[model samples]
Target: MTRSHRYRSLLLAVSIAVPAALGTAQAADTVKLGLVAELSGAGAPAGTNWRDGAKLAVAEVNAAGGILGKKVEMPEYDTQTDPQVSRALVQKAIDEGVIAIIGTVYSGSTMVNMLVAKQNSIPQFVGSEAPAIVEKGNPFVYRTSSGAQKGVPALTPYFKDTLKAKKVGVAWVNNEFGKGGRNVFIAEMKKAGIDVVVDAASEQAQTDYAADVAKIKSANPDAVFVYMNQEESARFLIEAKKQALPMPLVGEVTLTEAKVIELAGNAADGAIAHVGVTATATEVPGIAAFAKSFEDTFKRKPTHDAIKGYVGVWATKYVTDKVGKVDGEAFAKTMHGLCLKAADHPKILLDTCWDDRGEMSRPSFMVQVKGGSPVVIGTVPAN
Candidate 1:
């Protein structure tokens, strides 16, 4: 080969090799995200929903060419619904250089892990709606689901005006989630001028609510507000129906889950609950397509937990992209006042990105179980 020709060939090779090396280096700089879930224990169903939902969103993000020139890497751990386990997992994620954390289906676990996130200043996006999660003054924490403070106000009016309920009986599990929810419900119901004649608090995960149901029946409430997990809630409903309590049953978001209906069977019929979204609501923005896509991917309809997680990932991506960096502080600064358009739908579920307190401000919906499915009653205004 001539000297000049050899020189040109070497230059071309150098140019190709430089870009190739840079590409490899860029690929190696992956953005790690931590997903803390309840992959075992009683919370597994909802936790798995959250995990799968976030995974689907991550898949979509990567398929669309990733973010900041690197693929997002989700390092996940199952907390088994244990707060201590969740706390350790949070530290592990932070130590492993994760920029942000998502999930922990149960409120208790989220609260525990979020404290660690606060100490480390790593942003935590939780799926729980307990009022206390955002009340801890942790700037690093944010939520996709509306909490009791937001849900109760919306629920109280529906009980009074929509359902025409006068005297309501209250049943809740005695835990952070149930107590916080009960306190808010009582305060709101009083404001609505509705009487809560029977206030019954049950032990967490108690199987037999026969005694509690009897007291509620003795009060003969026009409607009953129940705040419990799906298993206990279903057990209570089945027993309540067997005794023919006969009043309309109303509850928080958990009551709207398909699992509740499936567990409660015919007992779930005529029950009312507050829900953020319904996959069956075709009028909802992007719900039809989101449902279709989700069913195709998972071969089943997505739950409220799934949708919350999906939105959480997308919301995180929105802020990260807007800031041009995967940073917790930067995202937190702009998290409030930024309106998020959901990737799958235009239903405007998250009307306000987040309030000053880091609580998600979104419209609420009341759904009723008719033929064992959640049918939308109407929208509940935040104010």
Candidate 2:
């Protein structure tokens, strides 16, 4: 080949290959987000929901031209609902250089990952609402949603004043998630002058609550705080109906998820709990259009997970914008300092963005299962 022609070909290769390689090293569009959750086994349902929520947000960001022209990378890991597995998964993500992680869903799993993140100085955005998530003030961790201690307090007073239940009973899975809640609800109820008639624990993943239900029924509680997952929770409610045990039922935010209605059907009726922001697309600004797209794609309605995911994407946009460029530590620190207000939804444009102790400042609300669906009852303050 002629020297001139060969030189031209080599120049073209250099121009194309070098940029491509650098692009690999550099974060693009927004930033790379890593997630650790129980993507399989019993925890898969919640993990899948969490994954979908983040994806909903990512799609919107990409459509709007991404965060600082860098798109979000939502690569995730399956911790299989085991804390040790979650730790290993997060450590792996850190090695691969993910700037932040969205979830390690189960509280037990999150505790494991939280330690790993603290040790490595990696920022982990946990999906946990358990109070223990923030008690340590670990600089490297951020959690979305309120702590059980913070989130559940407002509801207790209501139960005594509004529901007028004299004796309260509590049942939960014997894990960090359940225990975190049992501790707060019991303390708050006692301080509220409500009698604690029943306190019980079940296996973390137990399917049957018949025996537990009978035991709880024996306590004669005027109301009961059920702190199990969606399926078990639904079963408890259904069994309550079957046994003709009559009382008002209350629970934490987990009770507001769509799964409760789907799993329990009419049995879920009359159940009451607090709701984090539930911004549907129409009421939200940029999100309305995005939610429309998700509904068309998924057929089923977009849920809390989808909204959480979208918020992560939107928050990343703010963080990346300030960073001026993408570096792991830089983006992470920016995220920690980020304060956002995204509520395009005209009716319920809930504001849920902040950097307070590395978590969002959500306006918590109360919802009741009126017709097998949650209906807003009251709003709670951030403090």
Among these predicted structures, which one has the highest lDDT? Answer: 1
Residues 135-178, candidate 1: write the lDDT tens digits. 88888788878888887677876787777988998999887778
Candidate 1 worst ten-residue window by lDDT: 343-352
How many clashing residue pairs are found in candidate 2? Answer: 18
- Which stretches of model 2 miss by more than 4 angstroms? 1-30, 279-293, 327-338, 343-349, 353-356
Worst 10 residues of 2 by lDDT: 341-350
lDDT, candidate 2, 224-313, per-residue tens: 888876666777788877777677788887665677678888888888877565433243365466556667867766555556555554
Please give the TM-score that candidate 1 achieves against the real structure: 0.89
Quality of model 2 by C-alpha lDDT:
0.72
The per-residue C-alpha lDDT of model 2 at residue 221 equals: 93
| Top-scoring candidate (TM-score) | 1
Residue 281 error for model 2, in Å?
Answer: 11
